[model samples]
Target chain A: MKKYNAVFACLLLVLFTNSAAASSSLEEYFYASGKIKVVITVAAIVLIGLFVYLQRLDSRLKKLEKNKIEK
Target chain B: MKLWLKILCAVLLFYALLSSFYHPLAPGGLTVDIEKLVPGANTFVYSGYNTHFKDHSNDGLQFFVSSGSHYYPTEIIEVIDNNHAKVNVVLPDTLPSEEIAFYANTPTDGTVYIMKPMDISAFVFHQNYTNGSVPVKVANDQHQNFGYPFQVIIFESIRNLMWHVPMWFTMFVIMFISFIQSIHVLSATGRENMLDSSMIYVQSGIHDRKASASAETGLIFCILGLITGSIWARFTWGAWWTNDPQLNGAMVVFLMYVAYFILRNSVNDEEKRARLAAIFNIFAFVLLVVLLMVMPRFAEGLHPGKSGNPAFSSYDLDSSLRMVFYPAVFGFILLGYWIYNLRLRIKILESNEEI
Candidate 1:
């Protein structure tokens, strides 16, 4: 509890001190010069493909878990 | 899963992913060179975003300085490229407002507004010519074509809606299925007598497996949603995480499910574990609803669909977006279910070995 309280206070101090400084640098990443359709499509496909791969890995892990439990 | 359903999910997701990039946004924003205007002839370099300005050079392209309900017309000097132009606006003797917004209209490009309003009174000069009255609202000459709405901050990141939002939607759906299976597991105790003893035991095991498997798949979706959401937030909100009600609430919900997994591992008795986990699952789902959906709308947050921010439904997800968005939602949900089924099958095989 004492550690948590100290960490919380540190966070509060950082947030207050950084509030004004944070607004100076605006986000400019992925601005895409007004044309981002290709980027969007590519990102969507990659993420979807990645999730599919994860699902396959999950199934394999489940199979391993089943085998270990059975043994 | 049915073979046809699996094929449909694949086809629909492929279609949604491909079709989302096909539609273009309507010309709805302008980037202007000058931020301050004096009472005289002002020539500002205007750049159009997601607009075909060169194509509409033959049509009447006009500019305006507009206050509430009134507009002062400007002269278009030249078109530099397909998406850049120069316009000249002559300020009158008396200004309509200290700050006025810029509006541009072309027959092909519809109407576009500068994201930032220019201060007309920033620089003062002698008033030589007085325009008698500010021109009232005139009907836009150009007909708007079907396209995505161009917003300033979320100009392109608006596309994140199709990918990010559907993740949570799919997660909720899978979690709800787990919740239902958990309830069934709790009630299946005495109902076991309705079937053969061994068959009833298998049925109860199946229920337990399904409940856990769905929760597992839901966890995967939840994590993906958070990752995708964090990327979108970094671009638009300027931070990976903001102190918004919705974001904090989502984090809380995710932590609760993590705790759920820990709880499942602590218990040794199968029946006791299933029962306790079921009750915890119901509680977590209730928290999920209250935190992610209900609580955010009551407080001011940077996320859309909150108290201060305008919901996207009003303007962002135009008809073209909805065409792909609805299919994406369905496709991802089906894919989640497919993953859940695989997990459930593994669980059943493990339990059969025990018997």
Candidate 2:
């Protein structure tokens, strides 16, 4: 859990810096074409978040099944 | 839970995803370049978001300026392009009302109008000025196209409705399941007939596991809903986070549920933990209702439906939107249930292994 927290913190730092660097262009890109890119960005976030959550759950279940076999 | 239901959920989601992006937006007024209308001839460019002015230029394209009940016709100088037109309207020296509105009518795009406050101090205002002498042809035909209503700031981002709204709905359904399971956990302890205390403990333990599993799933959805809503708010409402009552309420609900998990984990004894967490869950659910449902209605906020009896106005959930939104809601709720089911099975297995 501590390892996961560290990884997430690092990921957030990278994302924040990257966004800060290209904030102007990113805002322009999202606002252009009647702000359709905003919708795409939201959809991408939902899809990726759900996938990541499912992957974590799958790994945890795998660990539990392995422990049961060992016992 | 059932194979058929899972397939139906998949199909509904697919349909929602397809239709949400596939449908076009109805033509609406975008902007009029003129700042103020003077007494003499006023020529300004009119731009539309999704309209065909060029195609209908020679056809039935007409423009009008309306003041109160009187309509004054405007001459179309030129159709610049499909979405642009230069219009010239001559206003009378004495006007009935200073409140002026511009209207554009086309064969394909129907009628789109823009109302802007004009600097009408230059023109003398007469209450009984007869400006209705000229016979003006106003096309009352609605836009024939079947599409989502085109909102100004929320143009294509309106599509986010299908994705963002369903997350909260799904969270509500999952949390309700968690609430019901928590009630079972509390009630199981009240039975007097059970001679074996171990039996009650086992039964309540199963309910506790189910409750926690569903709550976990509900929390995931709640987070998703918050993120999506925040993103939507940024572009439309000009901020990622607003002090809107609904928004603050949602944030509090999220924190409260996080507290629920912390409370569950802190207690070591199984029976005591279940009993305490169940009571806390009941309180959390009640708080959720008051914060999200009851309070938002009374307070004025940026979110629509606040200060209004219904959650959404008729214009917000038009027939075209309903076609896609209903399926999206059902799909997400089923998906939440499916996730909760899987999580509950895992929790039950883990608890059994502990025994």
lDDT of 1 by residue, B1-355 (tens): 9999999999988876665566676566557898677767889888777676787777766678764445677778988987788888876656544446777777676677774755655543333422533554443424455566677867665666667778889989999999998888877755766767676665566777888899988988887777777767766777879999988998998899999999999999987788789889989999999999899888889987677577666674345567778898999899888878877876676576666
Please give the CA lDDT of all the candidate structures.
Answer: 0.73, 0.84
What's the C-alpha lDDT at position B209 in model 2?
A: 94
Quality of model 1 by C-alpha lDDT? 0.73
Runs with alpha carbons beyond 4 Å of true place in candidate 2: A1-15, A18-25, B132-141, B308-313, B316-318
Interface RMSD of each: 4.0, 0.8
- Cα displacement (angstroms), candidate 1, residue B262, comes to 0.9
Error of 1 at B314 (Å): 0.9
- Lowest summed lDDT across 10 adjacent residues in model 1 chain A is found at A23-32
- How close to the true structure is residue B205 of candidate 1, measured as C-alpha lDDT? 62
Per-prediction CA RMSD (Å): 7.0, 2.4
A1-71, model 1: which lDDT tens digit per residue? 36546865886687467544654432322555653642464365447645664656676667777778787
Calculate candidate 1's fnat: 0.12
Superposed on all Cα atoms, model 1 deviates from the true structure by an RMSD in Å of 7.0
